[model samples]
Target: MKQHFFVLAALCFAACSKEPVLPANIPTDNPALPANSFTTFNIAKGNHYCDKTAVHVFSDSSMSVKVRFDSSCIYKTIDPGNQDDINKLVGFTEGNNNHLHSARFGWRWSDNALRLFAYSYAAGVRSSKEIATLAIGQEAKLRISLLPTEYVFAVDDTVVTLPRALRSGIANGYWQYPYFGGDEVAPHEIIIEIEEI
Candidate 1:
């Protein structure tokens, strides 16, 4: 009886000792971008509509754009809006409406200048800090590079590294365009870097 009990206990311990499996799509190699080649846009100016020159070049198969949000910066502009707007702005709105607005950025064209909005917060009763913006005609570059364990964004050589949890799972290779929508009285550009860490 004692021998049988010992065997049963050993079997149970072995079964519980198996290692946990990791996620399937973790990135390993560092992604490279063009040498000094980047997307350039002319800032639009006006209400709800602005004119912008388009330079549409899709990212490589090992790169992706992720949406990010600073919780301290929500509900500071306009009014409350849906997450679908984020998906739509980043060219992700297709079938379902499960949009996560906090992680999207793009551009919208109008009649005057090409307006730009970097980090936007849906209109609500929340106090947010100022929205980040790039000047009209300012050159912006998007490159994927590795600085130790973090993925860095090199905009005109100004590097910003994202958190490891969010950087590791980004989908590689996708196309994105500028989008514009809302009751704001001016066309704007969408410029943001979102992460889910």
Candidate 2:
């Protein structure tokens, strides 16, 4: 009878001590994928935000990440000119509560190819510059360096610089993830594989 009671207590403790489960939509390292370092971000159809919203505090002078886009990134917009509108890639919002004081790498499928851009906002003003064109399914290294007066954005061989609002310090904020659309949500489900290097 004592053995039975002990067994029941053990089982109850085991049941209550299980690890917490993450939501199904959160981005996680999939062993099935060829590279475990890569995290696949999924943006559902008709949604501007990706499934992953994991927050990361960043206070570094530079951030670098490698990203790859699959065929799902290819899409046509209702308005032809909207094709040039840049979508947020990897970045972080500077200061507090205001995305207007931020810098990020941007990408878009335009002119029959995938292109990367240096996108940013300084003191509530917006600016973007085309950095380079990258091939789909190919990993590209992107880096953003926060400087006293500007931001240095580099994608492989190409580099572009944009103005920085804060004159003298490292960035302090949360990491931003993949996002879609300027005037429209994702045309279809989009999958982007990213690994911070």
Scored by TM-score, the top model is 2
At residue 127, what lDDT does model 1 achieve?
Answer: 15
Write down the lDDT that model 2 would get: 0.84
Report the Cα lDDT for residue 121, model 2: 88
Off by over 4 Å in 2: 1-36
Per-residue lDDT tens digits for candidate 2, residues 48-81, read: 9988775556677888888999999999988888
| Model 1 segments more than 4 A misplaced | 1-134, 146-150, 164-170, 181-197
RMSD to the true structure for each prediction, in A, is: 14.8, 6.4
- Count: clashes, candidate 2: 0
What lDDT would candidate 1 get against the real structure?
0.32
Candidate 2: residue 28 lDDT (0-100): 53
User: Residue-wise lDDT of candidate 1 within 4-115, one digit each (tens)?
Assistant: 9999999998888667654566432322222323322222334232233222223231233333222211222244342213212232211122131122233332232222
